[model samples]
Target chain A: MTAEDKILPKPLVSVRGLRKFYPAGRRFPWLRSKPPILALDGFDMDIFPGKIHALIGPNGAGKTTLLKILWNLIQPDEGLIESNHLADDDTVLVSGEERGFYYRLNGWANLVFFGRLSGNSRQETLSRATQLAERLRLSGILNRRYQTYSSGERQKLAILRALLQAPRLMMIDDLAKGLDPQATRELTDILLELARDGMSILLATHRLDLAAQMCDTITLIHRGKNIATGSPQKLSQQVFPHRHYRIVLSGDEVTARKILAGSITSDIEIKDGHLSAELVVSDEEELAKLSLTLAQNGISIIELSSLEEELETVYNHLLQDSDSNDG
Target chain B: MAAFFIRDLQIWVSYRLSLFLDIVGLVGTALAFFLLGLAFEGYIPPMLEQYGGYFPFVIIGIAFFGFQSNGLYGLSGSLREEQLQGTLEPMLSSRITPLSLSLATNTFSFLRTLVRAVLFLVLGALVFSVDLSSMNIPSAIVVLALSLPPFLALGMLSGAFTLAFKRGDPVRLVYGGLSVLLSGLYFPYQLLPQPLQWLAHAFPLTHALSGLRAALLNGASFSEVSTQIIWLLGMGVVLLPLGIVALKLGHRKARRDGSYAQY
Candidate 1:
């Protein structure tokens, strides 16, 4: 066997040639189409022992479907998913969706309900619920009904419920949504610690910053297909060239744009009476030279920063690629 | 299985106060009927005379029917309510088997129904001088046990339809109509017309009620009601698996068709 195969202490989970398609409707059942609405056309990805894989995509991009499939929330129409981690990896962790909790129940009750469902004994489930409440800083309001909790608190409770299972593979759907800056940072840190403790994490989120900070690898999905997969830095450097600098000048925007026309080889836009030009420069020295020239030209430099393209840019790029390829 | 059971317990505790109110309401209805029976004791003889002067038999039927009715309501009713609130998928995705989960979900209703049935039995007899003392209490218990599988199975079958077809009233109507006509709640099977007699015989609920009445009211021995017991057991054995398998398959079908969460 290969070294890679040997290192997979247990086969965490495997998805082979997964396919899912939804028929349009029963009224037009006889009306045929060339292809069904392929939610997950053909997906192949392995979540190994200790990696936080971020699944980033736009809305309707099939990230949620893939997570659902892996969680076995619903079976795939045409695929084989086998896991050596059945007793261990069987937990389907999800957050921020309305259905993942009982609204009438308090946070602790909901946790205990799920813990027992995950095969914990009553005593064990209760203890774990208490522990989770304390850890998530929800001890103060663990007795309050979930409906009365704020969106972020509910999301945290959902995460806590999932954590009570001590899941082998934690699948967080869109956790960063509705979280403030500090909470998001704390969550990222917790995820990182979970990863360090040998749990595989699959986070689906629109926020690229969280993914960059926490995830070891990233999977970019667009329109139900795996478009790109790589490490965060690799994907960033490959997809987003560090060759551009954004110069924000506060002045008569039209005149600033006219002045920067000499420096602009790419696109430029004027917003809120400010001229932000995307200029290509090799290094900081060239950028500094351009900054001085702009200063000399009476363009008050309100802000100057290195413009790094994010996963969103890559997402839109892949979308444009698909669109033009179809055209 | 124990874990699943306790899961049900925790779920009940979560809504314990609201469930107490519902229990009060159900038991209150039965109590009102008992009081009305007291005020019009003379008019209730037809009900007592036709069913062997044992008001508990009638009470048991009503209590069981109330539970079965609640199960039907809970299955279809919770489906609609949860579907509207978009909580269906999360509940369905839990680690517990859907059969076990359904039982757990209806846990409070089951206890409420059982409590109401027993209270009505005691209260109805006190008011109407109905005889519930029986020589064959074990046989009566056996009959109750035998009837549960098919009753729960039928409840699940209705629940499966509710899971798939949200707006269709046909499933509920079929179950309600059959239970009323055949379950021997209001009258004896012999009192029904010939065609309806056969229909009642075909129903497991009828056999259960008959078996309970024979043991409790007629002082029938265990051997005497064995045939009815076997019939109840047979329906349970057959329909329980059928109902569960049908629901699981239907669930998968809906999920594959991408309408698993459809309202």
Candidate 2:
């Protein structure tokens, strides 16, 4: 990268070396003295403009803390955060739980309240709230108390409040947890629309399928650190190289085993009168040769599918790699 | 800051009627005591000479204390409830400073308190015919108004303590205990023992009550109550800064511990 390129205003949010800690013995009231839980330790990432980035990790992976830091809700202990772009423009950030809405107030009042908090005048908030209500398809129930709204409806309202400010950068944290399929789809569509209109979004979610479908890039975090950042397919291939391919064959078990065993270079397991094997094929030629060899052995191939969507596999692989290195 | 305050005032206005009812309950309770004072008006002239001058003083005292107590309680309660719902951090993330935010949050409750004080005084005057047009009335009002900052400062200091300590009930435990026994709410300060009298005098409320009684009931002139006015002013000056400093320090400590939003 050139000096001009480095100095260019490109990324909307840049973070480095973030740290947070809490007293570990806090949960045990009886323990008067103990070390604290290091909730976030040296988290680092940069989110660029106009790109939909997905942050994926396990339960204690510091996703929430990262989002909180990025939104300036909580400052990191030791790090640099550069968000000059958002400083100049209205940015919408929403947590998985609807945090900003008032339960006692009706939906419109809560929206307006938050709208005004974001520096909008009362008239502006009221007008923009109506528009947001219509956009979120919540116009009919705007006057109802927020507590009366269904969980999904409340989440949608929260999302609408976030968008009501006409944000340039939107941060969503683990938003796909409790939503049904239809709500998830609707949310995805709305997110796609926002991204298409040149709004940069950073979404933290555990659902790999959603990330795979929506995010243009993926940043995987494990234990408060970024383990991988690249395209979804690239990360998947890098993490799990020899895709776990399931082969179904209809033939004499002994013959099939003999034919498969001859070509396989690694492990093999037989179950339910079927043969499952892990083969090491380095190139297209080897794959073709193995298939041809099976065909010649009179083994009718019933199915051939690769296991790629199992997120646990990818997570465990990354975690094991980090654990081994630490050990 | 003022804008944030007004916004909070608007939210309070939305619930104005319910809040008014709560204030009414407070005033009604205070008026109950004033009625008790009226019961002995015939046989207790000597006692009345010393304390009868404090009837209106009692009325204002209860009304103002209720306003202060409930205002702080409601503001802190609302904040804690928001923390439960996960709104505290987000609201804090906004540009408004916590002082300004607090002022805004407590605006309605304070206004409600002021309005209730007026209503209670009117009801006390009509039923008991207590004279408040004495020369001391202005000084008493000034004392009450001046004492507001220190009182609010104490509330803010307690709020900060709550934020930092996470589970200390010092605000309620201390304020409730003192308000009942030492705030001069139910009786005059001289009725208590010498040590207790000194303890009561230490509080801002005591100075306010003394100044108000001297002005409204005893018909004392402003010059006559110069010492009490100085005491009230000194309390405001000393405690307000201390409270602000404590609040700022508590905020920093909580943030450093990564527990500022725990509530």
Candidate 3:
């Protein structure tokens, strides 16, 4: 590492106007050709220092394509990617679902082989592999042939190989793939720990619940473009601007319904002629005022709670909006 | 470099039956040549008289020509194997340059071929009783040293085509087939037609086999084989750079088209 003072506050990876189009085979000459599918189009993103960012999208949303571009494995037809000067050589790495491993070699042998290829010394690689294996709980399987390892174990091995040198920028795709819930949680915790230790992580995942739990920032992509990029809460606000409140109270149903219906949008439930209500308020002030008015009307509140919008809901809502617009 | 060799050595040693067959095949092939040479001893061509007999002459041809073919096929063969095993892309993504990777991938096969070639000569002398051997060892080594680059260069060109097209390699299919027939492995060069011999001169192996047979059978000195050495070196000079350029072009095209991992 160079002098810490020299590190730039600018984005570590600044991507702008990226575009990629895969070629489709042509056979018919008499008819006009259909437009090719755009895998990435005018996409832009910025990864800052020591933060966990996620790329989340539906199928065919180009999340994998974007990560492949960022890793320099695939070149975009048009784009500018200003790499972070501090990240060079083995300082950056990527882990994907690609089974680029020797089937006959034992797990430890593969790690050492790949570690050396990544510019690590043999002794250094063995030591690091042992440490990482223990951490990943893969120590038990290190002696087994790679072909015999389970899918979850295989993914962990990929992560272990990626972490052999403690890269500053690590990109992983298909996060939580082939992993059990416990393994996914363990992986997420370690990723969070790595980020806290000043490693910037970029993960492409379909699991919004896990992404919301782990990522500091989430970017929703659709049709090969970024449709939304922000914190989970900020994106939820973008989807659900009004706050949702649920309350159960013994009150005059007519009066409560009259005020809520005129002033806000709400749902009221009645069971055995008893009233419970849910309302959408635009702001904290509105929620507070509604509480006061209910108290003023002798509506004793038995239960009241705010409903937080989940990342999955926000992701789905944004995708729906994007699809509607495209349609 | 050591890693590449060790990785392949470990894997190659793991296949016990294949390893057994390798030894059997080497001795068997040399034995066949010795028997053929014995049967045709009295009818030896005048051009081969200086080489003592057909056994001594043919031994040098098969041994060194096999070495040359190893360099020609080892690189692209390893590449195809790795690509099928899904291990090629990761190595391609590593810190090593394409040049180093290409050379390193072939290192194990390179030395293995040299060892097999030396053993082939030993078997001919020990079991076949070819001759006491007035071989100029240093001259033979010089010819081998001069001859390998062009074959390896040809291997790189073949591997470059495999890397880009990710399918049938025209370079290897056409070049490898022609070299075996033209390199004078199983026959004397003088037996070929005039126009064919002219075409054979363009291949480095023709000169390489001639130089090796002369050094081993006739005890030709380094200076005596200068013409063959010069031709081999010239081929190396022209082909090595061309091979590297073709490899770079293939790598770039594969990256641009996103076909590196397709195979």
Q: What would the TM-scores of all predictions be?
A: 0.79, 0.82, 0.90
1 against 3, candidate with superior lDDT: 3
Summed over model 3, clashes come to 0
Candidate 3 docking class: medium
Model 3, residue B177: C-alpha shift (Å): 0.5
Among all windows of 10 consecutive residues in model 3 chain B, the one with the lowest summed lDDT is B89-98
* Per-residue accuracy of model 2 over B124-213 as CA lDDT, tens digit each: 677667665553557667767777776777777776777677666587568757866786766676777999988887777777666766
Chain A alone, TM-score per model: 0.73, 0.75, 0.83
The digit string of per-residue lDDT tens for model 1 on B66-104 reads: 666765666567666667756566566665566875676
Model 3: per-residue Cα lDDT over A98-203, one tens digit each = 4778887899889889889888899999999998888888999999989898777887888888898677788888888878888788788888988998888998
- In terms of DockQ, which candidate is stronger, 1 or 2? 1
Task: Please list the residue runs of candidate 2 whose C-alpha ends up more than 4 Å from where it truly belongs after superposition.
Answer: A2-9, A25-32, A88-91, A242-312, B1-31, B38-57, B70-75, B133-137, B169-172, B218-221
RMSD of 3: 4.0
* Cα lDDT of model 2 by residue, A76-179, tens digit: 77878777547633566677775557676788777666767677877898888788777778899988887788767877887888787787788888776688
In terms of docking quality, model 1 is acceptable
Clashing pairs in 3: none
Candidate order by decreasing lDDT: 3, 1, 2
State the lDDT at A14 in candidate 1: 72
Top candidate on TM-score is 3
